[model samples]
Target chain A: MGRWEPNARGRLEQAALELYVERGYEQTTVAEIAGRAGLTERTFFRHFADKREVLFAGAGTLRDDLVSAAAQAPPGAPPIDVVATALAAVAAPFQGRLESVRRRQSVIEANAELKERELIKLASLSAALAETLRERGVAEPAASLAAEAGIGVFKVAFGRWVGEPGGGEFARIVREAVDELKAVAAGS
Target chain B: MGRWEPNARGRLEQAALELYVERGYEQTTVAEIAGRAGLTERTFFRHFADKREVLFAGAGTLRDDLVSAAAQAPPGAPPIDVVATALAAVAAPFQGRLESVRRRQSVIEANAELKERELIKLASLSAALAETLRERGVAEPAASLAAEAGIGVFKVAFGRWVGEPGGGEFARIVREAVDELKAVAAGS
Candidate 1:
């Protein structure tokens, strides 16, 4: 293999997901995952810290991307709109990855530790989004409130998108979720 | 000590918080907590599964109470209003316990595992609230949206209450937080 094998990370992820689905997350070993990917154990370690890390690595990137997106939103946009713009940016990457996302979610749901980690990731994302909003001159409770509301909308929309894959566009679902969140908040 | 001691559970909780605040959650032991409470280790186990449980016991009670309050909300109340009523119910118990609550929060904030548990508890509360809303003829997305919004408001209000203990009443803070949540959701 060359020093830089193309898509090595993607192959490892694909292999890990398939093994997790076929053999259950608890029973699947890193060696089996690497073998399935036609790569060495070292290659697997190179991509992820452990088996669970493969499922969570994207969360870190997602958090960072989301923070940057919110920070770069227009100078005077409303806080919620800024958050919506940030979340909407993430929908494109998820368009063709529905199956993998579903399988990954199932695996996470099956494990308590993974579920805790998922919640932690989401909480961290909310905190980061709040910090970004604060940077935009938003004040205390409002900044946190808007960021958290954004996360709530994203979570509800993501669940809907995963369960009803072809029902509507992910971005559209997110918009509607935000609107619903607003309506719910408005007690309408 | 008498076997039928009054408020044994409350005594154990108070002792646990004192120990956690003084010695730190990691260094504190169940035996010490029981000792401070003038109880035996067996008595401690009767009330809590472990040392961590001392701080989290109220979560179960809070969940139960919130769900019951939602279920008992006046008929035809909006889903969000039902949630607001449920949250307002919790504010009563929280009064006169600000010091203990502050200590408990500090301990939880000091430990990552405790923080995760806290988030899990809040998420569970949200889920239970959603189910109660569903039982009240509320439909999908709305139930969850209102429930999640309630949680968001509760967290923000709780933070503000803790940070500024003498600022105002908990229920009033919660009300303002809910209004702010509505404003944020509305992109105000």
Candidate 2:
């Protein structure tokens, strides 16, 4: 094989997720994941630190997208509005990937370590969004509260989106969740 | 020592926290913690599953307090208000423990594993609150959103309280945070 492999990361992630679901996360091996992806274990190691990384590799990109969108929001927009808009914008990419997303969620939910990683990823995203809001001149507590609340909304919306039988759009659910959060916060 | 140790759990927790702060969590051993508490290793294990459990031992009691408070809220209160009130009620216990709380927070922040465990505790708290809200007649997304949003407020408020030099009251800070979250969610 050549030194470069096209889409090796994606291939490995897909292979790992499939194996995790089929054989259990604890039962799966890195060599098996690489072999299923039709790549070498060396190539796998080059792409991901381990099999778990395959599940969480997209977190960095997701955080970047959310932060960039938040940073680009209108200067005069409210902090919560900025966060909500950013959430919807980032969720757009998950529109057609419900099946895989559900599979991934199941895999994470089945394992304590993966659940912790997922929480950590969400916490990191919240912190990044809070920093972006702070840069936008939003003050303390408000920035952190808005960012954390936005993540709370996202988590609830994402859970609903994944569990819904009718398969709703992730972006729409996020927008509705933001609105629900507002109503809930207002004690209405 | 006999099989019964007076305040064994409390003594072990205090000893563990002191050791974790003084010698770092990883360097501290179960034997050292027990020795510091003037108890035996058997007594320590009788109280907690492991060293990490010392830090998290209060989570269950905290959850129960929050749930009980939520369940006892006035019948007509909004879900968000119920959560906020429960949060304040539960936070009152931390009034005189700011120093220990700060030390515990630092220890958890210093280690990735402890941080993950902390997140799991918070997540579990959120889930229990959501369940309580659902039983209170709050609907799907609203129950979850309110529960999670309340946890967000608590997190930000607790962080600020720990970092503040003047050492304000935890319940007051939580109240202020809830109001701030309401304002932020209102997009003001």
Candidate 3:
């Protein structure tokens, strides 16, 4: 392989997901992922720490985007609205990648350990959002509540999107989920 | 030891928590937990499958209580209200167990594996609540949204209750948390 591989990280992720889907996650190996990507194991390590990291590496970037979007929302808006808007904004990246996202979800769902890792990532994202809300002058309980509830909306919305056969818009589903949560909270 | 030990289960739980808090969850062994409770390893195994089970055994009963309360909620109430009412009802069990709950929380917090286990338990509880809401005739996204949001409220409320210097009523805290979440969702 050449010293410079364009989109090596992307290729590794694609390869890893394909392999995980083909051969069960437990049976898949890092060497197989690297070889499938047409890259060396050393290059794979450069992109991800382990086989599991291939599935979760995007979570860090997603959290950063969410926090950034939340931090930049209108100052006087309600914490929940800020979080909702941020969540909607962050849904853009997943718009055109429905199949890959669905594949990733299936892989994660098939493995107990991956499912736990996904939950931990979601929990950490909620914590980060809460911290960002606090930074925005939102008080405790409210900030935490908004952050967690917002994530709850995302989880439901994302699940719905993945389960949809037509592959609808991600942000639209998120908006609807947020509205549903708001109505649910209002006891309507 | 006598063939019959009164409150063997309770004693094992108490001993496990103390040992986990004192010597750390990683360093504590099943043998030590049994010894601390004046029981044998056989007794410990009979009560719990393993050391982690000592901390998580109550989750099953808690889930049952929450699901039953949710199922019995007024037929005409909104999904979120049903969930909130059930959550408050379940808080009754933890009213006088603040110290032990806080210790367990600390122990779980100190260990990554335990924290992941705790997250899995919470996820399972949310799934159960969602299922109960579905059985109550609530629709798809709405059922999941209410259940997840309810769990989010519980997480924040329980955190506040545990963090308080002078312990407050768990049910009251849950109600207040539910109200705060409602206000947040309403963009107040």
- Which residue pairs show backbone clashes in model 2? none
* Predicted model with the maximum TM-score: 3
Q: After superposition, how far is residue B75 of candidate 3 from its true place, in Å?
A: 1.0
Docking class of 1: medium
Q: Comparing 1 and 3 by lDDT, which wins?
A: 3
> In terms of docking quality, how is candidate 2 classified?
high
| Per-model i-RMS | 1.1, 0.6, 0.7
Taking the candidates in order, what DockQ does each have?
A: 0.79, 0.93, 0.92
Model 3: reference contacts kept, as a fraction:
0.95
**Docking level of model 3:** high
Residue pairs with colliding backbones in model 3 are: none
Which of the predicted structures, 1 or 2, would earn the higher TM-score when compared with the native?
2
lDDT against the true structure, each candidate: 0.87, 0.93, 0.93
DockQ of 2: 0.93
Looking at model 1, residue A31 earns an lDDT score of 94
> Chain B of candidate 2 versus the native chain B: what TM-score?
0.95
